[model samples]
Target: MIVVISGLIFYFVIRRIRKQIDEMAEVLEDIKNGNGNRRILSETHEIVAPLAYEMNDIITSYENRLSAFRETEENNRQLMTSLSHDVRTPLTTLIGYLDAAQKGIVTGRDKDDYIETARRKAHDLKDYIDVLFDWFKLNSDEFAITMNQVEAVELTRDILIDWIPIFEDKQIDYSIDIPEQPFRVNLDSDAYLRILNNLIQNVISHSHADKIGISLSKQNDKIAILVRDNGIGIGKEDLKHIFERLYKCDKGRSEKGSGLGLSIAYQLVEKMHGSITAESEQGRGTVFQVLFPLAD
Candidate 1:
């Protein structure tokens, strides 16, 4: 009688194990048919529980990777479309101005004006291409950052010095307040300079501001650098996407830019283990803050 009872117990255990195996097979089939969401529903005490957990983890990773691939594809499509339109439109206008001047359609001062317009449009095209190159280079795997300990205040001063003349030329009032005590950070000096230059360029080109302010301060272990402008500020909706690649506010749509400057700056900051944030109110002003941990 004991032997018979043991045989019965063995049969029941095999039957339950077979059931779980069948379920796992079904889930595999579903996944093969492109149903990435299908998962095995098995109790922790079941024979197949470990296998189920591992398979589920694999599926989750697969799904995440696939989603990322799709997003990247979409972004590439949008970038190409934007590039086509931007390049062609400016090229066409540039050709029109040059053609008018070449064909003598306008004479005297009008001809000179046409030539000047063509020159400006040419410069605009070059600027757009330069920005596009910068974006591509920064995204490429070959790009490298050479980080070293640098004095933040001195670096900021050097960067702003070049911009002083530009601010004067633009007739934009500006102030610089860098503390005498140096705050040091680990950074690629060129990348840091690019970040500052990009922010200042954005203000010069798009902010429509007459006054600008730059200040640097240290609090505890972190250093803060602020770039503020009294310009036509960003709208709430547009501000949310200002850092997105190729994003442009409605107010800046007519402006000549590849819309990649701030995005590149953001990427560079991340690579340097720093953070950047923007604050703005429409018709009031915009301020960009960059922070980094002090070098040990």
Candidate 2:
């Protein structure tokens, strides 16, 4: 009788162990089938408990990373789509204008004006292409700025001189207020020129202001440059998105712009280890403030 009782007890224990193993197997199979909700229901603390917890944690972390990656990818796709549409429209219009002129559809002063218009559109297209390429370089981590010690005052003067013809033609009154003392900054000359050119062109094309003001000064180990215009100021809502890629304000004037100027300028500023901000009130004009650290 004693031997029979011991045999019965051993049999019951073996049955319980087999049942637990079957349950664990079922849980793993559920997980394999994409049922992340399933978890092991262990009755007692054992080796499997730690493993179950680790598996759940790993799944959760993986899901979170995947979600973040999807969001980033969607945003990039939207940006690229928008950029393509915006860039293609102007290029198409420019081509149409050139074709008309070539076929003698335009004549006399109309021909001359049409040619000039085509040229401007061509320039606009080129500018858009340049901005798109630069943005792509920035996205791919291929764009780099070579920093060098540059005199802020002299640089400001040169930029002003280059833009004088445009200002004169537009009858736009402009003034440059630069300090007599040299203010040095660490920056890439090409990048800096591109930034200033974009900003000035934006003022001329979008501001519709008769007068533009530029000021350069040094303050507290940094150099500051301000570009201000007395024009139809940007609205509060528009101001927030002025620096976004392919963003344009005023649908009526959208045909005249590619909306890449401010975005490029903003990125170039960051590459130079500088900061840019804007202030504007509707009907009171806008001001762009750029600050760069002085080179050591």
**Which candidate should be chosen as best, given TM-score against the real structure?**
1
Worst 10 residues of 1 by lDDT: 250-259
* TM-score of each prediction: 0.89, 0.74
How does residue 54 of candidate 1 score in lDDT? 94
* Model 2 Cα lDDT, one tens digit per residue, 120-156: 8787777777876766776675667899998878987
Model 1 lDDT tens row, 5-74: 9999989999988988898899889988999989888789877789889988988898899999898789
The 0-to-1 C-alpha lDDT of every candidate, in the order given, reads 0.90, 0.82
**What local lDDT does model 1 show for residue 128?**
79
Where does candidate 2 stray beyond 4 Å?
Answer: 1-72, 250-255
